[model samples]
Target: MLTLLTGLAFGLSLIVAIGAQNTFVIQQGVRGEHVGAVVAVCIASDVLLIGVGVAGAGALVAAAPGLLTVLRLAGAAFLLGYGALALRRAWRPGALRADPSGAAVPLASVVATAAALTWLNPHVYLDTVVLLGSVAAAHGADRWWFGAGAALGSVVWFTVLGRGARLLRPVFARPGAWRVLDGLVALVMVVLAVQLVVRPVGGA
Candidate 1:
């Protein structure tokens, strides 16, 4: 029971961070787009990564410096691309809308974008792979319970963040609020993208 609670605490602490992935999830929720698919992908990806980490995939990944390098570069490119889009929207007057605008994008595109946001980010690897793995392994024989608890936290967080985002519809109905949110998201993505390119893992 202690192990499970510990895992839940750790997982919630990490997931609550305002990262690119969470930002995207909130945006989808606000737009009333394919929120279900995004939430599912985020939860499933977290579970898979945390499970693999508990299974010792983290150690294997640490051994392969090359793999981290490739992921770092790819993630940086994706972040930069997304950041540029956000930046354009942020600076372009009349871009922010109080309501959903334009036709809904294809579900395939939404899933692909969500997957890229999940898989490509090295921070996800760092969190689930290195951090969560180390935390769960500390439980020794009870590591699986810890992992399950952590996975539950992830499920709960994404569900709330995605589904509960609609609650913010009233606040986000203001165009200025959206501009602020997008501006913040763009800044975070661009800064993180720059950092990844400049100081990649293993100093690659």
Candidate 2:
């Protein structure tokens, strides 16, 4: 039980931070376009990564510096591209409708983007697989329980983030709010991309 709580706390600490995945999830929630799909993907991905980490994949991943480099570059490129699109949306602010019934983003596109945002970010691997795995190792036989705790945390957090966003529908009804959101999203993506390029994820 204690191990589970510790894992939950650790997982939430890592996930609560504002990042590309959270940003994208929030946007989908606000837009009310495939929110369930986005949240599910995020949660499933987290579970898979945490499982892999607990299964000792972290050591293997860390052993391969080349793999990290490739992921870092690819993630950066994707972030930059997404950031540019967000910036364009901010500048134009055309599809800023708070109404879910507004022009819908195709379900497939939303799912793909969500997957890309979650998978491409090297930080996700570092947090879920590497860090979480290392921490779980300390618990020995209880590691699976810890992973379960972490998975639960992911499910709870994403569910709240994705579903709770609808409450802000009123605020988002205004075009200005959407403009601000898009601008912030763009800023976050670009900043993350730059950081990935500069630091190269696990690179010194």
Strongest candidate by TM-score: 2
RMSD (Cα, Å) for all candidates, in order, is 2.1, 1.3
lDDT of 2 by residue, 1-204 (tens): 999998999999999989999999888888888899999999999999999999889998888888888888999999999999889888986746646545377889999999999888888899899999999988999999999899989999999999998887788888888888899999999999999999868767
- lDDT of each model, Cα atoms only? 0.86, 0.90
lDDT of 1 by residue, 1-204 (tens): 888888988899989988889989998888788999999999999999999999878888778778788889999999889988888887875877778533367889988989998899887888898879988888899999999989999999999999988888888878888887788878988887888889967453
TM-scores for candidates 1 onward, in order: 0.91, 0.96
In candidate 2, position 167 carries an lDDT of 88
lDDT for position 169 in model 2: 78
Worst 10 residues of 1 by lDDT: 95-104
Off by over 4 Å in 1: 94-96, 101-103, 202-204
